[model samples]
Target: MNHKAWSIHFIYAGVILLLAGGQMYAVESYQLTPSATKFLAHNVGPGPETAQGAINHFMVNSNTGVRETITPPGWVAWAALSAGAVLSVHGGMLIANKR
Candidate 1:
């Protein structure tokens, strides 16, 4: 309800964003296990991305594993990094002002 409380929430959100951004940036790609991929395909039918002119994300099934082509935009990482930095800095400033 108070400024400090909001600041703490900001800090928490910023930290989570930072962690998520770091993870997204660090891992270029990942694959689901064969069994997991099979399960997913079985439950969720249709792969539009497999066809031409598909605007949505989709996964590829292969012997190795299933890989989803989400977060294809390169700017996502930079956006997350910038947002996290700004949020974290703003939160720290608010906390400092309280003292």
Candidate 2:
């Protein structure tokens, strides 16, 4: 194939991603509130600042009742939306550049 063909593919994939990702993110966002609460409840101590540690903390706290008054990452939905938007724009740019 050629650059133009590849660019067209990118643009199409990006549009699909934007639409699907938006819907998925919206649905998932609603279900995340409880998970977020649990995340806050688990991440209270001086646990390792790593993804693995966070998972471990959540698992450990799930077995026990360790509640905390901290804020979890609330920008998850917005961040996902922004990523979809970025992909859309990047694909648009690729199409434009190829044309």
Candidate 3:
């Protein structure tokens, strides 16, 4: 592997890791806004595992006569997780292919 190729791989890996970390942090800190809740309810469709269902459940489960911290919808978190994983894998592949 040439030095330039190895350096490129390292840069790609670093960028991907940073993006993944930032995405995870954002997902962890995000709250379900009122508009977002409405949007989910309207667009997420049916079923217990659906986005709307997850949002509804999270809301109901979290606030039961007490103030509790709200979290992002399941689908949102899952989307972030999948995106991060894919990016990480691509970065890994870049490093692995460097030669």
lDDT of each: 0.69, 0.61, 0.58
Off by over 4 Å in 3: 1-69
lDDT of candidate model 2 versus the reference: 0.61
Highest TM-score scorer? 1
Using lDDT as the yardstick, the better of models 1 and 2 is 1
In the range 4-98, model 1's lDDT, one tens digit per residue, is 99999888888888887888788776565666656656556555555431322233343545544334355777778778888898999999999
Q: Residue by residue across 2-54, what tens digits does model 2's lDDT show?
A: 76677667667667766765665556333334456566545554465777667
Query: How close to the true structure is residue 19 of candidate 3, measured as C-alpha lDDT?
Result: 72
Clashing pairs in 3: 1-99
| Model 3 C-alpha lDDT per residue in residues 1-99, reported as the tens digit of each score | 665566566566656665755676566555565655555554655645877677665664453432334565556555655565665566567666764
Q: In what order do the candidates fall by lDDT, top score first?
A: 1, 2, 3
Between candidates 1 and 3, the one scoring higher on TM-score is 1
lDDT of residue 75 for candidate 1: 70
Q: How high is the lDDT of residue 33 in model 3?
A: 56
Report how far residue 93 has shifted in candidate 1, in Å.
0.7
Q: Estimate the overall C-alpha local distance difference test score of candidate 3.
A: 0.58
